[model samples]
Structure formats: structure tokens, C-alpha cells
Target chain A: MTDTAIEAADLTLAYGRRREPALRGCSFRLATGRVCALVGPNGAGKSTLLALAAGLLRPTSGRLAVLGTTPAAARPRVAYVAQDKPLHPGLSVAETLRLGAELNAGSWDAALAAQVAADGELDPGARVRSLSGGQRTRLALALALGKRAELLLLDEPMADLDPLARNRLMGTLMAEAAEHGTTVVMSSHIIGELADACDHLLLVSGGRVRLGGGIDDLVHAHALVTGTGRVADLARHTVVESRATGRGLTALIRTDGPVDPAWDVEEPSLEELLLAHLRAPDAPALITPGTTPTRAVAA
Target chain B: MVEYRIDRRSGVATYLQIVQQTRQALRLGLLEPGDKLPTAREVVEATAVNPNTVLKAYRELEREGLVEARRGLGTFVRRSLGGAPADTPLHGELLEWATRARAAGLDREDTAALFAAVLEEKFPQPHAAPEQAVPQPQPPPERTLPQPQSVPHGTTTEGDPA
Candidate 1:
């Protein structure tokens, strides 16, 4: 069995006859049994990437795979929870979940769906239109979970949830992923929430993957160092993103080896790393952070 | 079938609460070797706590050899302590006090006296059962239960009465 749940190689996609591609040369492999967050600013092509993975939109160039099969061939193994709520407005929660089970053409566990609904605090008798935003999101999650797909794709799963609801939903997703070994690729704008839950992260910006790796390794490779001396002296070794405080300059430096004790070194958070990449021009083609880059394969 | 309770108003982090409850369950023989735990998802739903918190607790438990995770099968009670002495991590006692304080509506100061009284009444130190001995099987002490406090709007504790 292939260890990868989803793989994309040199993918370039555009909407209709649009002059510019929505996503260009995007490539990444989502390993099985890991939670990956696809993060980017608005119009950074997060949706396009998810769509290509889900087989909802065909890529104009390159290849995509879901569960070691071409996107089309792996449709049954992939479950896409679209950004637009896809529930039937007329259907009650139970009926909506039932319909999903019927439509997926994959293993569907009715009992699991009922359990997920109950766990998410959704009343099966409630109609879809009557549910609150958080409830609707939970219902979507339940529907996705019940499908028992090998790869689950979620687009902005926490978009409409309040802080508390978001926490609860994230928790549910994490638990489900850990317990079942489900390979999940979810997109989110909430960087902090994603940092806490996801083991691996993908930062997509300007139609390319600027940062990708395990969270710890990324943090270790990028040191937030502050010094009193002119930062240009440090520029050769580090990427200076900012200067700060009264007397010192704070720089985000990429180091190939252990950090020197002379400089106060702190790990850059996921958000800091993302912002740095999004700001730089002609950024490294792929910054694997503390590891060698893997070969990009077209599905 | 370990029974656990959590007060949403507690100052303690939820993961610490989970650790204490798991320890208590072990001491009480409520769970046996190989007993399945509610998946992290189930625990979060049951307690209304963060999933990461549940994971943190489970991870600690796994490290302590108190629980084991079976890939695709969920977490399970691995080895039973059987009333034997077990190491209570530093956070464990802090968590117990926090839980009691919330239940009784007491602040940090009030927790000490109540904790002392309970300790003296149950396992007096010395012949005192080991620090991690089974929670003395006594009826829950009769402390003045806190009157329900009006929770502030938008606070996470709003729905949960203290």
C-alpha cells in the first residue's frame, strides 16, 4: 500500500478560460495517518488545490492522485467536504446524513453517522436550514466522517464556528483522525488553531508552496534572533524579516546548523514563518525546513 | 466504567483534569487492563473540552504506561495500578485542587483547608497510603456546594453552572 494519501505534481489550474492560472506548479504529498493544513491568504488558490485533489476540478496541467490512483479513479476513496454547505435544505439532519451515505458509493456506516451526529450535538430531527452555522459545520463533519473514505478533504471546516465551537470541532476532527488513522487535508485561515492541531503544514502563497514540513522541524530551522549590531552582518546567514525593540534588531534567519549562543535564538512560530515566506520575493523554490526536499511526483 | 467529572469553571486546563480523572479511575479499579477508552472525540464531546487537551492527557498517560493507543482501534487502559503506588505528575495535585475549588466555588486560598480536611479524614499521612494510593473509598465529603454563579456573556462557562 502506498504511504501517501494524496500526491500532486506540477499542477497548474485555472477557472474556465481565465488568462491567469488560479494555482501554478503546486506539488505536495500528503502522507497517510497525518493531519495537514493547507494555509494561504484569500485567492491564494487553496480552494483550487483542494478541488484538484477532490476531482471536482480538473487541473489544466500536471497530475493529481488520491490514494495512489488518479483523481478520477480514486473518487470512492476520497471524500470532499466543500466550502459551500452541501446539505439538502429540505432534509433533516438524519436524512442528510443518510443521503450522503447513499450518494458516496463507498463504505457507509449508518451507526457511525448517528454516533457522529450525536457526538457533534446535532439533533437528527432538525432540518438543515434551521441549524445554526456551527451546527451546519458539525453536520458536514459528521457526513464526511460517516463516509469512511481513506482520504478526507475539508475546505475551511471552521469558517463559521464561534471560538468555542471551533475548538470543539477541531478537537473532534483531531480525535477522529488519530483514532482512525484517517489521512486529512484541510484548509484554514486560522493559523493558531491549525498550528495546535496539525502535525504537518503546507503554506501555499503566490501559486506555489513556500513552506512545507513537520511543525517542530520548521520551528527549529528558522530562528528569531535579536542583536545590537547592524543586521547586514547577519544577512549573509539569515533572512532579516524585521527589526524591533529599542536597541536591538530582530531577524528571522534560516540556519543550516545549530544556532550560535552569541545570538538569542527563539523558534519562529508557524504564523511567523508563513508571513516571512509570503513577504519575500523569489523565495526558495521549496523550503523543507530541517530536512531534504522530497522529489515532486505527478499523480 | 470509570466515572469522571469536570467543572467548566475550573481554573485548571482541561488536559490536567483528564490526567487526574484517568489516575483516579486507575486507583478506583474502574478500568482494567485492555479496557477501551472513549476515543478522544468521545471524551471531547462528553466533557466539552478541546481535542488537543484530550490528546495531551492521553499522550502523557501513554508515556506513563497507564494507557496505550492501538492504531485505528482507539486508546485503551493498558496496565491497572490495582491500588499500588503510582507517580502523580506535578500537575496532578494542582488539577485536583482546581476541580474541588470549582465545585465548591472557592479560590486558591480556600482549596488548601478543604484539601487538608479531606486528606486527614481519608488517608492520614504516614501509615498514610502512598501518595498515589487508591482514592480512599469514602462518600464524597460533605462540603458546602457552591450556589450557581451567573456566568458572564460570551464566556465559555456560560452554559455550565458552577
Candidate 2:
């Protein structure tokens, strides 16, 4: 098994002639056995990136790899749950499970799939058309877990579930990672939800990866400093965002070293760091040690 | 097995919360020596937290000599935090004292404030250095009313004019 779960180098993908590219020159590496959060604003190419990694969509330019091989070759070992969660509307819940079992045959885990379905109290006789949005999500997740794939790529997996179901499903996902060392990358708009369950993060914006690394490392790499000073005073650090508070200038800086003692420095929270980068698109990006690909990208 | 309730808004790191909860359970005699801690899988499955957070907490507990992990078996409590056990005479005495305080017309908040003040005076810094023992000075025999030191919100003596 490869140590790297997913690696992309200068990956670019375009839709049609009129619209901007979905992903443009995006690159990052996700290590195995990590629960990573893919977060970005609308049209930030998060879904496009996941699709590219899943072999469902091809990039217009640049390279992408899944499990140390081409995405197509890694399909059997990877599970991708699309945002729309397409399923046969006519098939009964039981029939859907049967179909999954048939498709994945030798590697399918029937008991695990059934347990996931049962956790949601999904009825076997119910048709897919009859299930609620949350129920369909539960069923989709059941198939994903049942496949016993090594890497799970989920796009906004918790968007429809109620709070209790969200918690329960998250717990199940965490347990799977704990036991089998599965690498999971799930995208979500809720920062608090992701903060609790994810140790690594990929912050994509404007078709580019703005931040990618271990959450703790990324948070520690920058400092939130507030002091009575001007922007010129912060010339030494890479300032992501800065605003003038009533008493002084408060800024988020990717620290070069120990910040000057004149400014009171504290670590920015994950949300604050993401928001700062998202607000200032031109800030120099910092891809910490592990998240960088072993092979350098061709400019 | 002890279940952890994670408060996302608590401002406490998730792993630290786990360690604090386990230590609290030990001090209260809820988790005695030889009791097995819930596996990381079980904890993450129930709490919806990342599995690493749970493992990190357990590793910290192991380093403190509060728990031991056997090769194949799960982690077990090695020793309990030293304090007055729940069913001991000290607890009974505290209960009686609480009853007297309530009868003396102190509201729950007032009593809590008073108790916390006394605890602060005695413990000084309960969490400063759990591993290192600090020599404590004995309290005087003649008890004087602990005029609850100026409370944070400055509402300690609000209702009573006396």
C-alpha cells in the first residue's frame, strides 16, 4: 500500500468555453490514514477536485494520482460519493444493497453495509424514491462503507442529515478510520463540524488550493497579532489579512520567526486562518512539509 | 466504560477534555483501578471525534502513569487520583455542611461561590502541576467566615445588604 493517499500537481480542469475553469493549477498531497476536510467557498472547485481524484472527471492539464497510481487504476480501491448521490430511484433498499454486493462481489462487506443502513432505521422494503433526503444520504453512505474501499472521497456528505444522524454517521466514519486506517477526505461548508472530525485540511478557493496541511501545523504556522502599529510595521511577516481595530492594527501573519514583542501574538483558530486566506486571495500560500508532494511540479 | 461529552464551544482542546473527564471519573471513584478505558474506536464512534484525539488522550494518561496499555488487550486504569472517595466520611461531612449552608438561607449560587472560595484558598492552583506535590500550610483551628473574596463579576454580596 502506498503511503500517500492522493497527490495532485498543477492540476487544472475546465468545463466549457464560457465559464472559468473548475480547478486551475491546484496541487497538494494527502497522507494515508488521515481524516481531511476539503473546504472552500462556492465555485471554489472542491467538488471538481474530488471528481478528478475519483477518476470521474479528467483534468484539462496537470497530473493527479490516487493511491500512488492513476485514478482509473485505483478506482477499485477508492470509493467516491458524489454530491448529488445518484441512485436507482426504483430499486428497493434491499435491492440496492444486493446490487452493491454484486458490483463489489469479493470485497463487499454485507454486514457493515447493513449495519450502516440499520443505524438510520432504513426500511429494506422502501424504494429509493420514497426515502427522505437524509435517508438517501444514509443509504449512499451505506454503499460507500460496504464497498470496503481503502480511500473514501465524500463531497459534502453531511449536508442533508439531521444533527443526531450527522453525529452518528461521523462516529461511524471515525471508527472505520480507527480500525482499518482508512484515508477519508470529506468536504463540508460547516467549519465547526469539520474541526471536530478532521485532523488535516485542504482549503481550496478560486480554483486553487489556498491552504493544505495538518490542521494543527497550519494553525501554528500563522499568528494573530494585535498591536498599536501600522501595516508597515508588519513588513517582516507574510500578512494574510489585516484590519484596524479601534485601539490598534490586528493582522494574521504567516510567521517568519518569533513575532516582534511589541505586538501581542496568539495562534489563530482554524476558522480564523481559513477565513483570512479566503478573504485575501493574493496572500502567499504555505504548504507545510508533509502535505507537499514528494515530486516537484513542472512550472 | 466512561462516555465523553465533547463541548465544541468549551474553548478547551478536545483531547484535554478527554483527559480531564477521565481524571474526574477517577477522582470520584467512578473508574477504579483495573477498569478498562473505552477503546479509541468505541470513543470516536460514540463521540464523533477524530480517532487520533482519543488515542492522544489515552497516551497522555499512560505517560502520567494513570493508565497502562497491554500489548493486545485494551488500556486499563493503573491508579485512581488521590482524594476523598465518594462514600467516605469526608463526603458525608461535606454533605452535612452543604445542608447547613442551604438552611442558613444561602442560595445555590451563593453556596457554590463560598465553596469555590474555600477550595481556592486550600488548593491555590488545583491544575498548576498535577504531577508535582506542593507543600500545603495547615488551616487555623478557629474558623472564621470566608468572606468570599471579591468575586469576578462583583455580584457576590448583591442580595444581602448586611
Candidate 3:
């Protein structure tokens, strides 16, 4: 099987005949056994992309694969938790878990499900409707954990969770990744929180890919340069965002070559860098796997 | 007993931040030899960071001889930076000198600049021996810490931390 958990080539999709495409020409490769964070503004098709990966929606045109199989074919091996974390309200937590186990009979992990329940402080006897939002999220994650699927596609998995619960869930998820080599794709609006868990990134905006690559390479390639006189025009790097400072221009730029010695250069935080790319959605994406920006993404 | 907390807003890498918090705790004598560090799972749960990130930080500390991992128990502090408190004789002299410099009307930044310059002159750095040729200075404790080892540069860039 291919090492990539998700791969798409010129993927595009539209909801209806006259509707604007929810995703446009999206292409990227997310390696197996890595946690990738998906981030963008609301209405930027983040949900659409997750749904597509989970086999809930078909790409209108172009090829997409999950776990080296078509998303639909991979459904049995992939566990997906929607934003709402849908579960039967009348069922007790134990019953909910029991139902998930029944549905995923061949691969269900009772131990993992129990661990998640314990971490979230869930009582299996409690009814789903009596649970808090965070508790419901926990139950949804527990259901996913019990499935023991190879790839997990989670949309805002931590949204309803408190900070402590969120951290615990991420910790549990990370342990799963390390122990079992599971590939996870999680969409979150919390940039800092996402940066902590995801080593790779796939940033989308307005239904188009803004950038994609290892987070370290992406961060290292870009820098914040503050210097005198039209620093934005620095020849080597691609200026992502530029602003006038008291003395001159301070810009966030992507540099493959050495930054000029005159500028006061600092590494931009992930949030700053992500926000810059998201702010300039029209700028051409730099599909970088390493230092050299070798691929030119289609416009 | 020092718990590492990651400030996501900071430019520091997660592992480096963990290392810095440990070192900072050491400097303040909050963490002593034989004290246990939070387990990898515990850190991951508290910080919401990748488990590997926590392991990487602990590994870095182990490499530095600052902490040791016993078989399945937990990581423990092996030693400390052993900095003296601010009231030490060396600091007393520095404070006395600072008062005189202030009386001479040196602004805060100027005083700091002049003090750094004087310290560098008086304690000229050791001549670069074969082993000491690299000139990378340690980052200030407050600045965003970096882990050249954890964060590798693409294509082996010259300024890459490693």
C-alpha cells in the first residue's frame, strides 16, 4: 500500500449545478502516520474537505484516495467524527459504545474505548442526552477510538471540550498515533492548539489551497524581516505580507536564499505565518516538501 | 515539582519550551536532583502537545545530562545549573556598580549595553580551541527557546540550529 493516507490530484467539488465549488483544484499528499492540521476561515470549505475525506461526499472531478483506497472503499478502515459528533440520545454511554463496537466488529478496541471514557470522566451508565457538550465530544472520540481505524478524520474534535479535556484528548490521540502509527487529519480554528499536535500542515482558504508541507520547513523557510527602505522589494524571498514600520518596512517573507544581513530577522510564530497566508488567499501557493519550493500549484 | 507549561503564542518550539521550563526551574532550585519530571503521557495530557514532542524534550534533557529516564518509572533531574540567588556577592557588586552608573545618568538600555560591553571585555571569551570553535551563544532564558535538533532546517542550511 502507498505510504500516503490521503492524496488528491486537482480535486474539485460543487454542491449543486449552479452553486460555487466548495473545493477547487485541491491537491496535496498527507503522509501516513502523521497528524496533519487543517485550518482556515469559516466558509473556507474546511468542513467540505473533511467530509470528502470521510467518504460522505464525492469529488465532482479529479481523483482522491484515503488509506490508498477510494474514500468510499476505505470507510471500513477509516473512522470519522463529524462536528456535531452525532450519537443516539436515548442510548446510555455504554450502549453507545456497544453499538459502535457492533458496527465495527472486526476492529473494535474495547480497551481503547474504556481508556477514552475514563480520560473524559464519562460514566457509561449515563444517557447521551444527559451528557454535556464536552462529554458528548468525548463519547464521539471514544467511539472513534474503539473503531481502531487506521485513519481518523475529525472536524473540530475539540470544539465542545474544555481546555483540560481538549489536552487530554489530544494526548490520548497522540499516544494512539505513536503506538499504532495511526494517521489523523483534524480541522481546528485554534491555530496554536493545532500547531502543538500537528507536525504537517494543509492550509486552505476560499476553497483553494494556500500552502502545504512539514510545519518545521514551512516555519524555517519564512522569516520576519524588519529593515530600512523598501525591504519588501528584497529580491530573493517571496514577500507574503509587508507593512510600513517607523523607520522602514517590516515584512513576513519566504526565503530560500540567505536573508539580507541588514534586516533584523526573527522567526515568525506559526500563527503569524498561517494568518499571513490566509490573509493573502490569492497569492500562489508554495507546495514545499523541503527547502526548495519545487512545485508550482495550479492557479 | 516544576510543571512545564507551553505558551502557544510564543515563537519557541514546543520541545525547546519544555527544555527551557526545566532549565529555568533548575536555575531557581525548584527542581532538584532525583526529582521526577512529569511523565510523557502526563505532559501530553496537560499541554495537548504531541507525545513525541514531549519525548523529544525529555531526550534533549537526557542528552544534556540534566535529566535521566529510568526503566518505565519516569524522567528525573540528574543535576542543575546551580545559579546563585540574586543576593550573592557577585550580584551585590553588580548592583553597586549599577547605582553608580545610574548616577552618571545612563539610561536603562545604555546601562545594560554598557554593562554587557564591560563584562565581555573583562571576561573575554576563551580562545576558540578546536572543540570550542562554534560561537553560538546560549539564548536568554526569557527569549523564545529553540531546539536545533528538534527543528531541522531544510537542505541543511548554514544557520540551521543543528
For the second chain, the TM-scores of the candidates in order are 0.52, 0.67, 0.60
Question: Per-residue lDDT of B42-115 in model 2, one digit per residue for the tens?
Answer: 99999999998898889878876678899889999877765555676777888999999999999999999999
**Model 1 Cα shift for residue B158 (angstroms):** 42
- Which residue ranges in model 2 land beyond 4 Å of their true spot? A296-299, B87-162
Clashing pairs in 1: none
If both were scored by DockQ, which would come out higher, candidate 1 or candidate 3?
A: 3
Ranking by lDDT: 2, 3, 1
Each model's TM-score for chain A is: 0.90, 0.97, 0.94
Which candidate should be chosen as best, given DockQ against the real structure?
2
lDDT for each residue of candidate 3 in B1-162, tens digit (9 for 90 to 100): 667788876756789899989988876678877789987766766677777778888887887667789997889877665545445576787788999989999999999999788766665544423343322222222232232333221122123111
The residue ranges of model 3 lying beyond 4 angstroms of the native Cα positions read A290-299, B1-3, B9-11, B23-39, B62-162
Q: Please give the distance, in angstroms, between residue A243's alpha carbon in candidate 2 and its true position after superposition.
A: 1.3
Give Cα distance to truth, residue A294, candidate 2, Å.
Answer: 0.8
Query: Quick one: how many clashes does candidate 2 have?
Result: 0
For each candidate, what's the DockQ?
Answer: 0.08, 0.28, 0.25
Would you estimate the TM-scores of all the predictions? 0.68, 0.86, 0.77
DockQ, ranked from best to worst: 2, 3, 1
